[model samples]
Target: MKILISWLGKTDIDHMQVDKLAAIATLATKHTAPFDTVLILANAWEEHWHDYEKWLNKRLAVISRPAEVEVRQQSLSSPIDYVAIAAVMLRNLQALCQGDNQVYINLTSGTPAMTAMSVLIGQGMYQCHFLQAAPDNSVVEVRIPLDFAATYKKAVSTSVRNKVIAGPSLSSEFSRIAAESDAMKAALNKAAKLAATDLPALILGETGTGKELLATAIHAAGNRSAKPLKTINCGALPENLVDSILFGHVKGAFTGANNDHAGLFEQADGGTLFLDEVGELTPAVQVKLLRALQQGEITRVGDSKTRQVDVRVIAATHRQLATMVAEGTFREDLFYRIAVGVIELPPLRHRTADIPDLVKQIMAEINAVFSKQPDYKSKKISSSAIKFIATQPWPGNIRALWNALNRAVLWADNTELTVTDIQNATVDAVKTDESSPVVPEFVAGFDIQQYIDGIKENIVKAALDKTGGNKSKAAKLLGLANHQTLANWMKNLGIAEQ
Candidate 1:
């Protein structure tokens, strides 16, 4: 598919924006190859124009093509009118989108002028797709087909319904990694079908939800199964070092570059590269990544010569890329490229019915680990322990279950592990301060306001603690009316802002 990126000149190359671009580029290279193009359109404001060349050059160097940069100079004396800019961009995009299979990346929120242009152009463009950068540096892509826009109002209404009903799915092979519930299994089956194809797959879920595991499973089952599986944790990398690690650097390319080294792309040649936490990439890296994926080649950091490599890509993240795209922290084009096929893994609590199977499998594995010692033979779990595990909400999912089991194993002196042993281990491992000043006990004749305030405070605090202080998440844990109500309660209690 052919891709186009149009943005206002005044956009800043912030860390978050760069990271979003990197994620997009990675996705594009992995899913859609040999047929993609990127177009960058910027207004001619002094600030926007000043760094244009540098930014353009850097971006061009990373992507796999000779970038087509278009600079439109608006009259400085005239007040910036976004509607006019949108018209201009739409006209330009219309010409580029003549092909039947075409996509547009709208990064029009870099400045007030660009934001206005994006909204107008976005609303008017019948056949184009729009992508926005979110505050957390993720991308949100909106695909507006020309035919759909013919009856725009109805199409929008139906789109929401379709998405809600679709939910998300994962590949079937994920079932082997963990015993997932029916809902989760269905999601996995959906993902498996998507993985069989060459589409870029975005694996979304919460932390420890096995996103990487799913990616690895996809690579293992794909046509490129014989190839190596390379993984990179985007969030863990240093911003400055990302380029060299990904695209390689020539000897003396930087201060620490004593010798030339092939980057991860080269190493993953004829295989798959799995990028974890892709939302953490920087814009500078994004530009280069966009080029590489588009062109199917890479140049060492300091080298002018480009080297080609063949590799498939799989990416995973826990954050909402759509939200990041809206806030101008991500690249619109990159988002569209990687989102060809999206799969979301369900959290642990949502699949409570699968707990029994998971517990049995975990116990078996633990037993296998202790197989060597006759005195430390495999132990059997009591019915009460199994029931207790089923009842407690596992916020951390399989990871949390594994940890809890480990703790229980440590505390179990008998051949059979019981509910008391598990409970004791959980209480001992969980952090709680006994030295802190205690709130007065609720008395039968307590003041009504005081009693209500105390209960609210306790409930809110417990939920926050359970979710590690993520307010939106804490609200879900508490089963609050919504995030707003949780926020109001937090404000009333004077708890620290999330």
Candidate 2:
């Protein structure tokens, strides 16, 4: 798409003061071809900047040069400060250049410093088209056939490019996610590399292994950090409501539809959308998701109009998607598109080396929450407690570990949580997993298959009862991929929900 990016200058709004057409209008009319989108960076402090946006759109329509106008507010210390102006312009330019966009930087708008920086950045980094308004309000190409600006351009471009991905900011973004084990370190290393680009990423790991947390860190460390980071759990969404929630619907499209609704994709434009438990998406939703990722566009459930969105999708799931694809349950094409950059996080059992640090971190968090309460003493775990924690096979991963520690802290009378406290808190979970199965007698007409089915039925019913008939929670308790798997099991076992 041909995109015209320009700073909204004083002349662009004060039409009564200008003798002829505004600089932006002239550039749009006299250009070789009409632009698909006009991206304007306006001053945030200007009270009537939105008025200028409306005026510019109307002016363009009057002249038959209709382009989608997107105004982004930029806060600058000074309009003439070349450094400040270049920083704002470079950041926006970098995001624009990420796509296959034919960028045109207009030098006739804003101050003289703005124009100069635009030319330097455009020539040095992008080599995009540069245009300016002539004396008679005609648009002319501005070309500089000089090599002196090469050094300055190279230095500035490199800084802008490396500042977020390769610099200290990258580390800071992931600082909240603590890891000490080699397996976890490797996973985080892969995540850091993926955060440097705008690729659709897939995070594969067991549940409670912090997939969403890692996804958040990746978004914070990427180009879309300045925009929204919307998140949703696909497994938690009701089957009937999935379409409307992800792609929205027009008013009167459905029985409950009352007004126009913006879905997660539209809400996360120029940002990131983290889809947790993505393997739970139905086949129909998979097709629509693939189209959105492939084309950067989506249509409402019952609307024919298509809307464009620039969303970096980060999907996470504990389910083995490759296995699902082979089983003809998940779409292979969608898998490949979203798995361009995959990070497989090791479960807490495999990362026992990091348990001590995790214990410290989680305990600190617990203390912070109860700090303000009167007579609430800060608690610390004994070394023996940490050792006991590391010895267990945490099937629920980090989340399970945190729950045990939080419980231990709350129940213990002293400030120091001992191994006894930890054991008491985690006893139910460990005992449940370690329970032995009943042995069957080897008698005539014993039908082993029927006996096994009976056992399966009992287990399913027990899990359902334990979770109060919530299929999703019961599935998690039974170690199933999602509620759908639980339902399939119940059907096969000839069991019914209470």
Candidate 3:
């Protein structure tokens, strides 16, 4: 059975009321193949669906088509509620996409969120053909490239399944992570699947992007849940004690080695070992780390014999290891080993839709801490305050957002925090921290050009997202000379235009 599925939009309703050709109408009349059933999803008032179905039936009859019309209400908390939209898409697809049923998804007749969800779910999870109707009354099949389609299918299918099983995404270890954007959800979906195996996983993201939190979650959800999950910050490890700390040492092995100490690899035996900022490891340490990962064994600093240890390594770094490999800093062999199950976490700015939920969670934690104070006074943030906070570029990611919220709550002298409070908080957050303005630490092997290009990529992408991919508007936002300048920069930076 061939079926066409679409969401009822305001423009679609208006066109039907005026007896003009709507997006769905155009699809039905112009598409080469005829649909056996036309399923219309409506999420508006009750009366809207009734009138829409009536007009839809009349139009189909006028066209002399015998397609059956079915209208169903797809409830949502709001037009842009990504969680609700994903769940609805999953349920509908699970029901309609049975064996031998050909499904056609109309990406032309709905809100941007609706259309996006349809594309992601339809193209990624199911064998559904997609159609988009332009204002010219022409309908075209939306084709996704093969490689991306396969990845999209895997990531999106996992996301939908996790959301469905968790029932509102609140119970499971993966569900507890608050997220509303597709980027974060996709990352989480990949993480959950990686958790099921003992493969070495690499998580890449900016600092304060919750790499450690994700590593811990993967450990807790994996088969090694009963064993110890040891964590070590390679960046903070003492240069002299790096070998002793990682592979352990026997008594009298070194000047300070008075006792036989077990290192992290030994301690994390039969479980997972999280290597935070793995890119910071020195060249010598990388060889030993790679040995342990490949041989499943390690030798003490002064010991000639190697002892077996079962450990799954989950390494994370803000640095681009591939760049390091090209520069001959990080080992290429180790890179491929840990990158078997790589997951790149999107920075907080890219997943701004999650800010509100993160705010709520942070506020609850703050309120709980404040309740213990003698002169505690809990505060609520106004919607405008949230909107204002969401507009800024949080270069520091979640950690930055948390600090800003904390500052706002502490400095604001009111029960309810307003936009002014948020604005003041942001200004104060950027003020000079000591003698001069604060500066980020430049570590060894830091690529200044790569860093600059990263900032440009982020800013350009944010502008494009804000302007709905309009080159002219995005150029204006970035203070560029013109859209042509923006285009040149985008091409140079490899920032693809959607």
Please provide, for model 1 over 283-364, each residue's C-alpha lDDT reduced to its tens digit, 9 standing for 90 to 100.
Answer: 7766777787777788888998766667777788888899988987778787777877888888887877777777888888
Flag clash pairs in model 2. Answer: none
What is the C-alpha local distance difference test score of candidate 1? 0.68
Q: Each prediction's Cα RMSD?
A: 20.8, 12.5, 27.5
- Give the range of the ten consecutive residues with the poorest summed lDDT in model 3: 428-437
Candidate 1: 10-residue stretch with minimal lDDT:
26-35
Comparing candidate 1 with candidate 2, which one achieves the higher TM-score? 2
Which digits, one per residue and each the tens of the lDDT, describe model 3 over residues 1-498?
Answer: 889999877888788778888888888777888788889888885676777777777877877876888789776868887756877787798899998999999998878998888888887789889998988989998886655576768998997898679774222777768779999999998898888789899999998899998999999988899999999999898878888888999988989888988899999988989999999999988887888888777889888756667789999999999999999999999999899999999998799898888888888887787789888799888887787677766778888888878888888889898876766666534422123213545899977787677667766876675565899988986799899999999999998877
Residue-level lDDT tens digits of model 2 in 1-498: 888999988777776235347878777766889888888888753676666667667777887888888778876767887766877777788888866888999888888888889888887777578888887888898777865467778887987788657654335777767777889888888888788889999999998999998999999988889999999988787778877888899999999899999999989988999999999988887887888888877888789876667799999999999999999999999999999999999999999888988899999999999898899999999998788788777778999998988889889999999877886787555433324346777788988888778777767875665455889988887789999999988989878866
Candidate that beats the other on TM-score, 1 or 3, i.e. the better one: 3
True lDDT of residue 111, candidate 3: 82
lDDT of each: 0.68, 0.83, 0.84
Summing lDDT over every window of 10 consecutive residues in candidate 2, give the lowest-scoring window. Answer: 428-437
Any runs in candidate 2 off by more than 4 Å, and if so which? 1-170, 372-374, 431-498
lDDT of 1 at 261: 94
Show where candidate 1 strays beyond 4 Å.
Answer: 1-172, 370-375, 428-498
